[model samples]
Target: MKIVLASASLRRQELLKRIIQDFHIVVSNFSEDSIMYNNDPKDYVIKLSQGKAREVSERIDHEALIIGADTVVVLENKIMGKPKDEGDAFNMLKNLSGKWHKVYSGITLINTKDGKSISDYVCTKVKFSHISDEDIQKYINTGEPMDKAGAYGIQGLGGIFVEAINGCYYNVVGFPLNKISGMLKQMV
Candidate 1:
Protein backbone atom coordinates (compact mmCIF):
# COMPACT_ATOMS: atom_id res chain seq x y z
CA MET A 1 0.00 0.00 0.00
CA LYS A 2 1.14 3.50 -0.80
CA ILE A 3 1.31 5.90 2.11
CA VAL A 4 1.65 9.67 2.07
CA LEU A 5 2.52 12.08 4.83
CA ALA A 6 0.88 15.47 4.46
CA SER A 7 3.30 17.67 6.35
CA ALA A 8 6.48 19.57 5.69
CA SER A 9 7.90 18.71 9.11
CA LEU A 10 11.20 16.92 8.91
CA ARG A 11 10.68 15.62 12.43
CA ARG A 12 7.44 13.93 11.51
CA GLN A 13 9.08 12.39 8.46
CA GLU A 14 11.99 11.12 10.57
CA LEU A 15 9.68 9.57 13.13
CA LEU A 16 7.49 7.96 10.51
CA LYS A 17 10.57 6.53 8.83
CA ARG A 18 10.98 4.24 11.83
CA ILE A 19 7.69 2.52 10.97
CA ILE A 20 7.13 2.85 7.25
CA GLN A 21 9.61 2.73 4.39
CA ASP A 22 7.56 3.11 1.27
CA PHE A 23 5.87 6.44 1.54
CA HIS A 24 5.87 9.89 -0.01
CA ILE A 25 5.97 13.28 1.67
CA VAL A 26 3.85 16.18 0.48
CA VAL A 27 3.69 19.45 2.35
CA SER A 28 0.17 20.59 2.93
CA ASN A 29 -0.71 24.17 2.01
CA PHE A 30 -3.58 24.48 4.46
CA SER A 31 -3.64 27.74 6.37
CA GLU A 32 -2.60 27.41 10.03
CA ASP A 33 -4.27 30.69 11.00
CA SER A 34 -7.63 29.00 11.60
CA ILE A 35 -6.15 26.71 14.23
CA MET A 36 -4.70 29.60 16.19
CA TYR A 37 -8.01 31.43 16.40
CA ASN A 38 -10.01 28.36 17.41
CA ASN A 39 -11.13 27.95 21.00
CA ASP A 40 -10.57 24.22 21.48
CA PRO A 41 -7.02 23.05 21.01
CA LYS A 42 -8.04 19.44 20.52
CA ASP A 43 -10.52 20.28 17.83
CA TYR A 44 -8.09 22.70 16.30
CA VAL A 45 -5.40 20.11 15.79
CA ILE A 46 -7.82 17.42 14.71
CA LYS A 47 -9.28 19.74 12.13
CA LEU A 48 -5.84 20.73 10.91
CA SER A 49 -4.76 17.14 10.57
CA GLN A 50 -7.97 16.11 8.82
CA GLY A 51 -7.67 19.03 6.47
CA LYS A 52 -4.17 18.07 5.47
CA ALA A 53 -5.06 14.43 5.04
CA ARG A 54 -8.10 15.32 2.96
CA GLU A 55 -6.03 17.59 0.78
CA VAL A 56 -3.64 14.78 -0.01
CA SER A 57 -6.36 12.16 -0.29
CA GLU A 58 -8.08 14.17 -2.95
CA ARG A 59 -5.10 13.72 -5.23
CA ILE A 60 -4.58 9.99 -4.61
CA ASP A 61 -7.76 8.00 -4.30
CA HIS A 62 -7.73 4.17 -4.08
CA GLU A 63 -3.96 4.28 -3.82
CA ALA A 64 -3.00 6.19 -0.74
CA LEU A 65 -3.41 6.29 3.02
CA ILE A 66 -2.66 9.83 4.05
CA ILE A 67 -1.44 10.73 7.52
CA GLY A 68 -1.51 14.23 8.96
CA ALA A 69 -0.66 15.51 12.41
CA ASP A 70 -0.68 18.79 14.34
CA THR A 71 0.86 19.50 17.72
CA VAL A 72 0.63 22.46 20.12
CA VAL A 73 1.55 23.43 23.65
CA VAL A 74 -0.94 24.60 26.24
CA LEU A 75 -0.45 25.88 29.76
CA GLU A 76 -3.16 27.05 32.11
CA ASN A 77 -5.75 26.95 29.33
CA LYS A 78 -3.71 29.13 27.01
CA ILE A 79 -2.52 27.64 23.75
CA MET A 80 0.99 28.63 22.75
CA GLY A 81 2.09 28.27 19.15
CA LYS A 82 5.37 29.02 17.39
CA PRO A 83 7.06 32.26 18.35
CA LYS A 84 6.60 35.08 15.90
CA ASP A 85 9.92 36.71 16.67
CA GLU A 86 13.03 36.43 18.80
CA GLY A 87 11.47 38.49 21.57
CA ASP A 88 8.43 36.29 21.40
CA ALA A 89 10.65 33.27 21.81
CA PHE A 90 12.26 34.80 24.85
CA ASN A 91 8.89 35.60 26.35
CA MET A 92 7.67 32.09 25.69
CA LEU A 93 10.73 30.62 27.30
CA LYS A 94 10.29 32.85 30.32
CA ASN A 95 6.67 31.84 30.66
CA LEU A 96 7.55 28.16 30.37
CA SER A 97 10.42 28.33 32.81
CA GLY A 98 9.90 26.13 35.88
CA LYS A 99 6.35 25.26 34.89
CA TRP A 100 4.46 22.28 33.59
CA HIS A 101 2.70 22.36 30.28
CA LYS A 102 0.65 20.00 28.13
CA VAL A 103 1.73 19.17 24.59
CA TYR A 104 -1.01 17.74 22.44
CA SER A 105 -0.51 16.07 19.07
CA GLY A 106 -3.64 15.35 17.11
CA ILE A 107 -3.28 12.71 14.37
CA THR A 108 -5.54 11.90 11.45
CA LEU A 109 -5.38 8.88 9.16
CA ILE A 110 -7.49 8.71 6.05
CA ASN A 111 -7.81 5.76 3.70
CA THR A 112 -9.05 6.90 0.36
CA LYS A 113 -9.86 3.45 -1.03
CA ASP A 114 -12.23 2.57 1.77
CA GLY A 115 -13.12 6.07 2.92
CA LYS A 116 -12.18 5.19 6.50
CA SER A 117 -10.97 7.85 8.86
CA ILE A 118 -9.42 7.86 12.31
CA SER A 119 -8.73 10.87 14.50
CA ASP A 120 -7.07 10.82 17.91
CA TYR A 121 -4.96 12.88 20.26
CA VAL A 122 -1.99 12.24 22.54
CA CYS A 123 -0.84 14.55 25.31
CA THR A 124 2.42 14.80 27.22
CA LYS A 125 3.23 16.80 30.32
CA VAL A 126 6.60 18.51 30.27
CA LYS A 127 8.21 20.35 33.16
CA PHE A 128 10.89 22.92 32.56
CA SER A 129 13.94 23.95 34.49
CA HIS A 130 14.50 27.51 35.71
CA ILE A 131 15.69 28.93 32.43
CA SER A 132 17.26 32.35 32.69
CA ASP A 133 16.84 35.20 30.22
CA GLU A 134 20.40 34.74 29.02
CA ASP A 135 19.83 31.06 28.39
CA ILE A 136 16.66 31.85 26.47
CA GLN A 137 18.54 34.28 24.26
CA LYS A 138 21.32 31.82 23.61
CA TYR A 139 18.78 29.13 22.78
CA ILE A 140 16.90 31.41 20.44
CA ASN A 141 20.11 32.47 18.78
CA THR A 142 20.66 28.84 17.91
CA GLY A 143 17.56 29.19 15.72
CA GLU A 144 16.19 25.75 16.59
CA PRO A 145 13.02 26.96 18.28
CA MET A 146 11.86 29.26 15.52
CA ASP A 147 9.78 26.70 13.60
CA LYS A 148 8.90 24.43 16.51
CA ALA A 149 5.70 24.64 18.43
CA GLY A 150 5.81 26.32 21.84
CA ALA A 151 9.08 27.97 20.81
CA TYR A 152 11.09 24.89 21.70
CA GLY A 153 11.90 21.54 20.19
CA ILE A 154 12.45 18.77 22.68
CA GLN A 155 14.51 16.79 20.20
CA GLY A 156 16.96 19.64 19.68
CA LEU A 157 19.22 21.86 21.76
CA GLY A 158 16.15 23.06 23.65
CA GLY A 159 16.08 19.70 25.41
CA ILE A 160 18.24 21.21 28.12
CA PHE A 161 15.35 23.28 29.40
CA VAL A 162 13.13 20.27 29.94
CA GLU A 163 13.37 19.00 33.48
CA ALA A 164 11.05 16.06 33.00
CA ILE A 165 8.41 14.66 30.69
CA ASN A 166 5.45 12.44 31.60
CA GLY A 167 4.50 10.94 28.28
CA CYS A 168 5.73 9.65 24.94
CA TYR A 169 8.99 11.27 23.93
CA TYR A 170 8.09 10.98 20.29
CA ASN A 171 4.79 12.70 21.02
CA VAL A 172 6.66 15.72 22.29
CA VAL A 173 8.82 15.53 19.19
CA GLY A 174 5.59 15.86 17.12
CA PHE A 175 4.43 12.31 16.38
CA PRO A 176 3.11 9.46 18.53
CA LEU A 177 4.62 6.40 16.87
CA ASN A 178 2.92 3.71 18.95
CA LYS A 179 -0.54 5.14 18.57
CA ILE A 180 -0.11 5.79 14.88
CA SER A 181 1.37 2.36 14.32
CA GLY A 182 -1.48 0.63 16.13
CA MET A 183 -4.10 2.64 14.28
CA LEU A 184 -2.48 2.03 10.92
CA LYS A 185 -1.85 -1.66 11.46
CA GLN A 186 -5.53 -2.38 11.79
CA MET A 187 -6.23 -0.49 8.61
CA VAL A 188 -3.36 -1.73 6.51
Candidate 2:
Protein backbone atom coordinates (compact mmCIF):
# COMPACT_ATOMS: atom_id res chain seq x y z
CA MET A 1 0.00 0.00 0.00
CA LYS A 2 1.20 3.53 -0.70
CA ILE A 3 1.54 6.10 2.09
CA VAL A 4 1.26 9.86 1.69
CA LEU A 5 1.72 12.78 4.04
CA ALA A 6 -0.61 15.75 3.70
CA SER A 7 1.51 18.51 5.13
CA ALA A 8 4.47 20.70 4.19
CA SER A 9 5.92 21.02 7.69
CA LEU A 10 9.48 19.70 7.81
CA ARG A 11 9.05 18.95 11.50
CA ARG A 12 6.01 16.75 10.97
CA GLN A 13 7.71 15.07 8.02
CA GLU A 14 10.77 14.34 10.11
CA LEU A 15 8.66 12.98 12.95
CA LEU A 16 6.71 10.73 10.60
CA LYS A 17 9.96 9.55 9.05
CA ARG A 18 10.98 8.10 12.40
CA ILE A 19 8.03 5.67 12.13
CA ILE A 20 7.98 4.78 8.45
CA GLN A 21 10.92 5.41 6.17
CA ASP A 22 8.93 5.23 2.94
CA PHE A 23 6.20 7.73 2.12
CA HIS A 24 5.29 10.50 -0.32
CA ILE A 25 4.57 14.13 0.57
CA VAL A 26 1.47 15.74 -0.95
CA VAL A 27 1.10 19.24 0.42
CA SER A 28 -2.55 19.82 1.20
CA ASN A 29 -3.91 22.80 -0.68
CA PHE A 30 -6.28 23.39 2.22
CA SER A 31 -6.37 27.00 3.35
CA GLU A 32 -5.67 27.06 7.11
CA ASP A 33 -7.31 30.40 7.73
CA SER A 34 -10.67 28.96 6.82
CA ILE A 35 -10.82 27.21 10.18
CA MET A 36 -12.89 28.76 12.94
CA TYR A 37 -11.75 28.56 16.53
CA ASN A 38 -14.23 27.12 19.04
CA ASN A 39 -11.98 27.45 22.11
CA ASP A 40 -11.59 23.68 22.20
CA PRO A 41 -7.95 22.99 21.42
CA LYS A 42 -8.23 19.26 20.80
CA ASP A 43 -11.30 19.56 18.62
CA TYR A 44 -9.81 22.43 16.69
CA VAL A 45 -6.63 20.56 15.92
CA ILE A 46 -8.47 17.38 14.93
CA LYS A 47 -10.66 19.35 12.57
CA LEU A 48 -7.70 21.05 11.00
CA SER A 49 -5.81 17.80 10.54
CA GLN A 50 -8.81 16.03 9.08
CA GLY A 51 -9.37 18.92 6.70
CA LYS A 52 -5.83 18.60 5.41
CA ALA A 53 -6.11 14.87 4.94
CA ARG A 54 -9.46 15.20 3.21
CA GLU A 55 -8.14 17.86 0.88
CA VAL A 56 -5.18 15.70 -0.08
CA SER A 57 -7.40 12.67 -0.54
CA GLU A 58 -9.55 14.52 -3.04
CA ARG A 59 -6.51 15.70 -5.00
CA ILE A 60 -4.75 12.36 -5.22
CA ASP A 61 -5.71 10.31 -8.27
CA HIS A 62 -4.71 6.97 -6.72
CA GLU A 63 -5.32 5.04 -3.54
CA ALA A 64 -2.95 5.68 -0.63
CA LEU A 65 -2.69 6.06 3.13
CA ILE A 66 -2.63 9.76 3.92
CA ILE A 67 -1.46 11.28 7.21
CA GLY A 68 -2.28 14.78 8.40
CA ALA A 69 -1.30 16.61 11.59
CA ASP A 70 -1.73 19.99 13.26
CA THR A 71 -0.13 21.38 16.44
CA VAL A 72 -0.69 24.38 18.69
CA VAL A 73 0.67 25.80 21.92
CA VAL A 74 -1.86 26.88 24.52
CA LEU A 75 -1.15 29.17 27.44
CA GLU A 76 -3.82 30.12 29.94
CA ASN A 77 -6.51 29.30 27.41
CA LYS A 78 -4.79 31.33 24.71
CA ILE A 79 -3.66 29.64 21.54
CA MET A 80 -0.33 30.56 20.00
CA GLY A 81 0.25 29.49 16.46
CA LYS A 82 3.21 30.31 14.20
CA PRO A 83 4.51 33.80 14.70
CA LYS A 84 3.44 36.47 12.23
CA ASP A 85 6.81 38.21 12.45
CA GLU A 86 9.96 38.54 14.53
CA GLY A 87 8.18 40.88 16.91
CA ASP A 88 5.35 38.41 17.26
CA ALA A 89 7.83 35.67 17.95
CA PHE A 90 9.43 37.79 20.64
CA ASN A 91 6.09 38.46 22.29
CA MET A 92 5.11 34.80 22.25
CA LEU A 93 8.39 33.78 23.77
CA LYS A 94 8.01 36.43 26.41
CA ASN A 95 4.57 35.15 27.33
CA LEU A 96 5.83 31.59 27.48
CA SER A 97 8.75 32.47 29.68
CA GLY A 98 8.60 30.93 33.13
CA LYS A 99 5.25 29.42 32.45
CA TRP A 100 3.79 25.97 32.06
CA HIS A 101 1.93 25.51 28.81
CA LYS A 102 0.17 22.78 26.92
CA VAL A 103 1.09 21.61 23.46
CA TYR A 104 -1.57 19.80 21.49
CA SER A 105 -0.96 17.74 18.35
CA GLY A 106 -3.83 16.40 16.30
CA ILE A 107 -3.22 13.55 13.88
CA THR A 108 -5.43 12.02 11.22
CA LEU A 109 -4.79 8.85 9.23
CA ILE A 110 -6.76 8.32 6.06
CA ASN A 111 -6.98 5.25 3.91
CA THR A 112 -8.13 6.62 0.60
CA LYS A 113 -8.84 3.21 -0.89
CA ASP A 114 -11.86 2.56 1.35
CA GLY A 115 -12.17 6.01 2.88
CA LYS A 116 -11.40 4.71 6.37
CA SER A 117 -9.87 7.27 8.72
CA ILE A 118 -9.10 7.92 12.41
CA SER A 119 -8.40 11.20 14.14
CA ASP A 120 -6.90 11.84 17.58
CA TYR A 121 -4.98 14.40 19.58
CA VAL A 122 -2.24 14.34 22.21
CA CYS A 123 -1.42 16.99 24.76
CA THR A 124 1.92 17.60 26.48
CA LYS A 125 2.75 19.93 29.30
CA VAL A 126 5.92 21.97 28.96
CA LYS A 127 7.46 24.43 31.35
CA PHE A 128 9.84 27.12 30.27
CA SER A 129 12.50 28.67 32.45
CA HIS A 130 12.65 32.36 33.12
CA ILE A 131 14.26 33.66 29.99
CA SER A 132 15.98 36.97 29.94
CA ASP A 133 15.35 39.51 27.23
CA GLU A 134 18.93 39.21 25.97
CA ASP A 135 18.67 35.44 25.69
CA ILE A 136 15.36 35.72 23.88
CA GLN A 137 16.93 38.11 21.41
CA LYS A 138 19.83 35.76 20.75
CA TYR A 139 17.49 32.84 20.25
CA ILE A 140 15.29 34.91 17.92
CA ASN A 141 18.36 35.90 15.95
CA THR A 142 18.77 32.25 15.00
CA GLY A 143 15.36 32.47 13.28
CA GLU A 144 14.23 29.11 14.61
CA PRO A 145 11.01 30.16 16.30
CA MET A 146 9.72 32.04 13.25
CA ASP A 147 7.97 29.06 11.73
CA LYS A 148 7.21 27.07 14.86
CA ALA A 149 4.04 27.19 16.90
CA GLY A 150 4.24 28.94 20.26
CA ALA A 151 7.29 30.71 18.91
CA TYR A 152 9.55 27.87 20.01
CA GLY A 153 10.60 24.37 19.05
CA ILE A 154 11.37 21.86 21.76
CA GLN A 155 13.69 19.98 19.40
CA GLY A 156 15.76 23.05 18.54
CA LEU A 157 17.46 25.87 20.44
CA GLY A 158 14.16 26.37 22.25
CA GLY A 159 14.82 23.14 24.11
CA ILE A 160 17.26 24.95 26.34
CA PHE A 161 14.47 27.04 27.76
CA VAL A 162 12.30 24.08 28.60
CA GLU A 163 12.69 23.31 32.25
CA ALA A 164 10.22 20.47 32.46
CA ILE A 165 7.98 18.39 30.29
CA ASN A 166 5.22 16.09 31.60
CA GLY A 167 4.25 14.14 28.53
CA CYS A 168 5.51 12.72 25.26
CA TYR A 169 8.53 14.73 24.12
CA TYR A 170 7.67 14.15 20.49
CA ASN A 171 4.27 15.73 21.03
CA VAL A 172 5.94 19.06 21.69
CA VAL A 173 7.95 18.49 18.56
CA GLY A 174 4.66 18.39 16.56
CA PHE A 175 3.86 14.63 16.58
CA PRO A 176 3.06 12.15 19.30
CA LEU A 177 5.02 9.04 18.47
CA ASN A 178 3.58 6.67 21.08
CA LYS A 179 -0.04 7.44 20.29
CA ILE A 180 0.59 7.51 16.58
CA SER A 181 2.29 4.15 16.72
CA GLY A 182 -0.70 2.53 18.35
CA MET A 183 -3.08 4.25 15.96
CA LEU A 184 -1.14 3.07 12.91
CA LYS A 185 -0.83 -0.47 14.23
CA GLN A 186 -4.51 -1.10 13.60
CA MET A 187 -4.34 0.43 10.13
CA VAL A 188 -1.50 -1.71 8.83
Candidate 3:
Protein backbone atom coordinates (compact mmCIF):
# COMPACT_ATOMS: atom_id res chain seq x y z
CA MET A 1 0.00 0.00 0.00
CA LYS A 2 1.15 3.55 -0.67
CA ILE A 3 1.70 5.98 2.22
CA VAL A 4 0.91 9.69 2.34
CA LEU A 5 1.26 12.46 4.90
CA ALA A 6 -1.44 15.10 5.18
CA SER A 7 0.49 17.98 6.63
CA ALA A 8 2.99 20.62 5.52
CA SER A 9 4.85 20.91 8.82
CA LEU A 10 8.56 20.18 8.44
CA ARG A 11 8.61 18.87 12.00
CA ARG A 12 5.83 16.36 11.33
CA GLN A 13 7.50 15.36 8.06
CA GLU A 14 10.82 14.80 9.78
CA LEU A 15 9.31 12.89 12.70
CA LEU A 16 7.27 10.68 10.37
CA LYS A 17 10.40 9.80 8.45
CA ARG A 18 11.43 7.77 11.48
CA ILE A 19 8.59 5.35 10.66
CA ILE A 20 7.99 5.53 6.90
CA GLN A 21 10.71 6.97 4.75
CA ASP A 22 9.00 6.71 1.36
CA PHE A 23 5.69 8.41 2.07
CA HIS A 24 4.28 11.19 -0.09
CA ILE A 25 3.52 14.69 1.24
CA VAL A 26 0.06 16.11 0.55
CA VAL A 27 -0.72 19.23 2.54
CA SER A 28 -4.34 19.64 3.58
CA ASN A 29 -6.08 22.95 3.00
CA PHE A 30 -8.33 22.41 6.06
CA SER A 31 -7.97 25.65 7.95
CA GLU A 32 -7.91 24.94 11.70
CA ASP A 33 -10.11 27.15 13.82
CA SER A 34 -9.62 26.04 17.40
CA ILE A 35 -11.99 28.71 18.60
CA MET A 36 -14.94 27.12 16.91
CA TYR A 37 -14.51 23.82 18.68
CA ASN A 38 -13.97 25.08 22.24
CA ASN A 39 -14.41 21.54 23.38
CA ASP A 40 -11.99 19.23 25.16
CA PRO A 41 -8.45 19.57 23.89
CA LYS A 42 -8.40 15.93 22.92
CA ASP A 43 -11.59 16.28 20.86
CA TYR A 44 -10.38 19.48 19.27
CA VAL A 45 -7.08 18.00 18.20
CA ILE A 46 -8.63 14.76 16.95
CA LYS A 47 -11.17 16.64 14.88
CA LEU A 48 -8.45 18.76 13.38
CA SER A 49 -6.34 15.75 12.50
CA GLN A 50 -9.27 13.88 11.01
CA GLY A 51 -10.26 16.92 9.04
CA LYS A 52 -6.80 17.18 7.54
CA ALA A 53 -6.61 13.51 6.66
CA ARG A 54 -10.11 13.49 5.17
CA GLU A 55 -9.35 16.54 3.11
CA VAL A 56 -6.25 14.94 1.64
CA SER A 57 -7.96 11.59 1.20
CA GLU A 58 -10.61 13.25 -0.97
CA ARG A 59 -7.94 14.70 -3.25
CA ILE A 60 -5.87 11.55 -3.80
CA ASP A 61 -6.61 9.16 -6.67
CA HIS A 62 -5.36 5.84 -5.32
CA GLU A 63 -5.52 3.86 -2.11
CA ALA A 64 -3.00 5.21 0.39
CA LEU A 65 -2.32 5.30 4.13
CA ILE A 66 -2.87 8.94 4.93
CA ILE A 67 -1.52 10.35 8.18
CA GLY A 68 -2.58 13.64 9.69
CA ALA A 69 -1.74 15.28 13.03
CA ASP A 70 -2.40 18.41 15.06
CA THR A 71 -0.69 19.74 18.19
CA VAL A 72 -1.49 22.42 20.74
CA VAL A 73 -0.15 23.78 23.99
CA VAL A 74 -2.44 24.33 26.94
CA LEU A 75 -1.73 26.61 29.87
CA GLU A 76 -4.31 26.94 32.62
CA ASN A 77 -6.93 25.36 30.37
CA LYS A 78 -6.39 27.87 27.57
CA ILE A 79 -5.28 26.64 24.16
CA MET A 80 -2.21 28.28 22.71
CA GLY A 81 -1.64 27.89 19.01
CA LYS A 82 0.94 29.54 16.72
CA PRO A 83 1.75 33.06 17.77
CA LYS A 84 0.52 35.97 15.69
CA ASP A 85 3.58 38.17 16.08
CA GLU A 86 6.80 38.76 18.01
CA GLY A 87 4.87 40.35 20.84
CA ASP A 88 2.54 37.40 21.02
CA ALA A 89 5.49 35.06 21.13
CA PHE A 90 7.10 37.05 23.89
CA ASN A 91 3.94 37.03 25.97
CA MET A 92 3.48 33.33 25.53
CA LEU A 93 7.07 32.71 26.55
CA LYS A 94 6.72 35.01 29.52
CA ASN A 95 3.59 33.22 30.68
CA LEU A 96 5.21 29.83 30.25
CA SER A 97 8.31 30.70 32.25
CA GLY A 98 8.78 28.63 35.42
CA LYS A 99 5.54 26.78 34.84
CA TRP A 100 4.27 23.39 33.78
CA HIS A 101 2.03 23.15 30.75
CA LYS A 102 0.41 20.41 28.69
CA VAL A 103 1.09 19.58 25.08
CA TYR A 104 -1.58 17.66 23.20
CA SER A 105 -1.04 15.94 19.87
CA GLY A 106 -3.76 14.20 17.85
CA ILE A 107 -2.96 11.66 15.13
CA THR A 108 -5.29 10.28 12.50
CA LEU A 109 -4.77 7.57 9.92
CA ILE A 110 -7.09 7.10 6.94
CA ASN A 111 -7.27 4.32 4.38
CA THR A 112 -8.55 5.86 1.20
CA LYS A 113 -9.74 2.50 -0.19
CA ASP A 114 -12.42 1.48 2.33
CA GLY A 115 -12.58 4.81 4.20
CA LYS A 116 -11.22 3.18 7.36
CA SER A 117 -9.64 5.50 9.88
CA ILE A 118 -8.13 5.65 13.37
CA SER A 119 -7.50 8.72 15.51
CA ASP A 120 -6.03 9.30 18.96
CA TYR A 121 -4.67 12.10 21.07
CA VAL A 122 -1.66 12.17 23.37
CA CYS A 123 -0.81 14.63 26.10
CA THR A 124 2.62 15.50 27.47
CA LYS A 125 3.36 17.61 30.51
CA VAL A 126 6.28 19.97 30.00
CA LYS A 127 7.86 22.26 32.54
CA PHE A 128 9.78 25.38 31.68
CA SER A 129 12.54 26.83 33.80
CA HIS A 130 12.47 30.42 34.89
CA ILE A 131 13.95 32.43 32.07
CA SER A 132 14.93 36.05 32.25
CA ASP A 133 13.29 38.73 30.14
CA GLU A 134 16.52 39.26 28.26
CA ASP A 135 16.80 35.58 27.44
CA ILE A 136 13.20 35.42 26.28
CA GLN A 137 13.82 38.41 24.07
CA LYS A 138 16.98 36.86 22.67
CA TYR A 139 15.15 33.65 21.87
CA ILE A 140 12.29 35.54 20.29
CA ASN A 141 14.75 37.50 18.18
CA THR A 142 15.71 34.24 16.48
CA GLY A 143 12.14 34.08 15.11
CA GLU A 144 11.89 30.40 16.07
CA PRO A 145 8.78 30.84 18.17
CA MET A 146 6.75 32.65 15.53
CA ASP A 147 5.23 29.61 13.89
CA LYS A 148 5.17 27.18 16.81
CA ALA A 149 2.47 26.36 19.30
CA GLY A 150 2.99 27.95 22.71
CA ALA A 151 5.57 30.11 20.95
CA TYR A 152 8.26 27.46 21.30
CA GLY A 153 9.79 24.50 19.52
CA ILE A 154 10.94 21.82 21.96
CA GLN A 155 13.29 20.16 19.47
CA GLY A 156 15.04 23.37 18.44
CA LEU A 157 16.61 26.21 20.40
CA GLY A 158 13.50 26.25 22.57
CA GLY A 159 14.59 22.97 24.14
CA ILE A 160 16.87 24.97 26.36
CA PHE A 161 13.83 26.46 28.05
CA VAL A 162 12.33 23.10 28.92
CA GLU A 163 13.38 21.78 32.30
CA ALA A 164 11.27 18.63 32.32
CA ILE A 165 8.76 16.66 30.31
CA ASN A 166 6.45 13.87 31.50
CA GLY A 167 5.59 12.19 28.22
CA CYS A 168 6.70 11.45 24.67
CA TYR A 169 9.12 14.07 23.38
CA TYR A 170 8.03 13.34 19.84
CA ASN A 171 4.47 14.38 20.71
CA VAL A 172 5.65 17.85 21.62
CA VAL A 173 7.49 18.04 18.35
CA GLY A 174 4.15 17.53 16.51
CA PHE A 175 3.45 13.78 16.17
CA PRO A 176 3.51 10.73 18.43
CA LEU A 177 5.53 7.95 16.84
CA ASN A 178 4.49 5.26 19.31
CA LYS A 179 0.79 5.93 18.81
CA ILE A 180 1.15 6.29 15.06
CA SER A 181 3.07 3.04 14.72
CA GLY A 182 0.57 1.15 16.84
CA MET A 183 -2.33 2.56 14.86
CA LEU A 184 -0.66 1.58 11.61
CA LYS A 185 -0.21 -1.93 12.92
CA GLN A 186 -3.94 -2.12 13.68
CA MET A 187 -4.73 -0.88 10.21
CA VAL A 188 -2.70 -3.69 8.68
Q: After superposition, how far is residue 11 of candidate 2 from its true place, in Å?
A: 2.0
Candidate 2 structure quality by residue, lDDT tens digits, 69-156: 8999999988999999999999999999999999998999999888899999999999999999999999999999999999998899
Against the correct fold, how does model 3 do in TM-score? 0.97
Q: Tell me the tens digit of each residue's lDDT in model 3 across 1-188.
A: 99999999998888888888899999999889632657489888999999999999999999999998999999998899899999999999999999999999989999988889999999999999999999999999999999999999999999999999999999999888999999999887
Tell me which residue pairs clash in candidate 1.
none
TM-score of 1: 0.95
The lDDT of each candidate is 0.88, 0.92, 0.92
What's model 1's lDDT at 92? Answer: 88
Error of 3 at 108 (Å): 0.7
Q: How do the candidates rank by TM-score, highest first?
A: 2, 3, 1
**Candidate 2 or 1, higher TM-score:** 2
Q: List the residue pairs that clash in candidate 3.
A: none
